[model samples]
Target chain A: MSQLLRQHIEKITPLTDSEFTYILSHFTPKKYKKHQFLVQEDAPVPNDFFVTKGLLKASYTNLNDGKEHILQFAWEDWWITDYQAYFNETASSLTIDCIEDVEVLCLSLHNREKICAELHKIEHFFRRKSNAGYVALQRRILSLLNSSAEERYHQLLVTYPQLFQRVPKTLIAAYLGVSRETLSRFSK
Target chain B: MSQLLRQHIEKITPLTDSEFTYILSHFTPKKYKKHQFLVQEDAPVPNDFFVTKGLLKASYTNLNDGKEHILQFAWEDWWITDYQAYFNETASSLTIDCIEDVEVLCLSLHNREKICAELHKIEHFFRRKSNAGYVALQRRILSLLNSSAEERYHQLLVTYPQLFQRVPKTLIAAYLGVSRETLSRFSK
Candidate 1:
């Protein structure tokens, strides 16, 4: 599992074995059963999870109509958290829960900052990650604003075929901001 | 104008006079007339602009319908670019144009990486900026998925009241993914 993290980071910035070990010491590993919540709305968010196994989702539940809006999903080699809550040190406005029994390496904001301040390479790695993540979110926002439901469905299918296999149709509909029937039609 | 960039960076990490001067040397000051495009779709994106004066928007034009969708607006102390193109060194997918006559400090990808590699504090500043940007994009995605047009209108009005004064109603409509008439109805 730690090798997963090492590889992920080394793809951007190579690390000496001792340096990787030092950085790895800052993270704690944890596990969760299926359907367990890693983060709950209005609770403080302290850690960002880097997934090593299984699948999970982060979502916002609309209070007025009780509808779920899927924000993101994470599986192996992915990261998940209520990042706004984590960075701001505020109560979360999203819930994150397991879609499968899960294992993740958790890094708290304190340790993240500590390691980033201590290591220039680690800081560069995170900066590059954040830049790429920013670009992905920008593309997603453009898709939501400009694409038709069918277009969005096709784009998702092309971008992450594995997601269609792993996620439920209803959850996929929520992520694409379409009705289940609309998604069904596109899939057919 | 240089002070704006210094202040923006200082908000995250304090810099010495010599450090700030060295960083500023990497940026070139440029001006654009209103309606001029900083970035054109399908053209190489060479620099990211830090706004020192006036306003601009980053948007995509849907080819089938010829409708524009606003992705972001930048004013004083804000950054704007085809970030996807800028980061990846690809042809732009979006067009960025000035809404008002604009003055900006431009940083190419090469200089950005150079400064970040050379200065740990600059890397920290950029990482923090990118994280904040990621969180803002997440909030926008949630709003797009969950909120009504009126709700989104009110949220934008509260968040950036000055935009209402400076940007045209039609552009505001594009930003909110609503018709101009619908935006007027909400404002009334």
Candidate 2:
């Protein structure tokens, strides 16, 4: 499990064995069954979960309609959090739920800051990862603004074919902000 | 000009005078008139620009309709870049242009990495800023998914009233992913 995290960080910066071990000490491991909730709306969000195995989704449900909008999906080696709540130490504005049986190493904001402040390379690792995440979110915003349902479906398939294989089509529709009927038309 | 950059970094990590001076040395200052392009599609993206004065927009033009989709707007003290192209060292997929007469300090990818590697505090500063940007984008994605154009318009107004005053309504409509007619109805 820790190997997954070490590999993830090493992609951005090399870590000596002792450094890696020290870094691992900041995280606590936990498991969740498929459909378990890691975060729920209006509840305090305490940790950012790094998925060591399985899949999960973070979503917002519209208050009036109770319609779920999938904000993001995370599979193995990815991180998921209600970031605004986590950083602000406030109640969650979104919920995160497991899509498959999952194992994650959870890090609180305090531990994350402690690690970054303590290890220069660890700080560098996080900065690089955050930049990459920013670029990806920009691409998603562009797609949401410019792409048709068919174009979005094709783009999603090309970008994350694994997601298409693993996730239900209805959820993909939610992520793309398209109706179920429209999703069927494009996927067909 | 350097003061703005110094203050921006100091928000997250206080820098000694020499350190701020060293960091500022990596950046080059330039000015552009309203409507001038800083980054053009298919060209190399060599720098990330920090706005010292005026406003600029980064956008992708859909090939099928030649319609522009505003990815983001950068005002005084904000940063703008074709980040995917800048970080990956590839041709730009979007264009960044002045929305108002603009002055910016440009930092190459090499310089940014160099500064971050040389200064752990600088790396921490950037990581914090990037995390905040990630959270903002997530909020935008939620708004795009769940809100009506009027709701988005009101949200934008409440969040950034300065944008409503500075940007043209057409561009605001483009950013909202709503028809001009729809935007007119909401604004009127």
**Interface RMSD, per-candidate values to 1 decimal:** 0.4, 0.7
RMSD of each: 0.7, 1.1
Please tell me which predicted candidate would have the highest lDDT against the true structure: 1
Judged by DockQ cut-offs, the docking class of candidate 1 is: high
* Per-residue alpha-carbon lDDT of candidate 1 for residues B15-126, written as tens digits (9 for 90 to 100): 9999999999999999999999999999999999999999999999999999999999999999999999999999999999999999999999999999999999999999
lDDT of 1 by residue, A41-73 (tens): 999999999999999999999999899999999
Q: For each candidate, how many residue pairs have backbone atoms clashing (under 3 Å)?
A: 0, 0
Candidate 2, B144: how far from true, in Å? 0.6
Candidates in order, TM-scores: namely 0.99, 0.98
DockQ of 1: 0.97
Candidate 2 per-residue C-alpha lDDT over A16-117 given as tens digits, one digit per residue, 9 for 90 to 100: 999999999999999999999999999999999999999999999988988899999999999999999998899999999998999999999999999999
After best superposition, candidate 1 residue B129: deviation in angstroms? 0.3
CA lDDT, every model vs. true structure: 0.97, 0.92
Q: What share of the true interface contacts does each candidate keep?
A: 0.97, 0.85
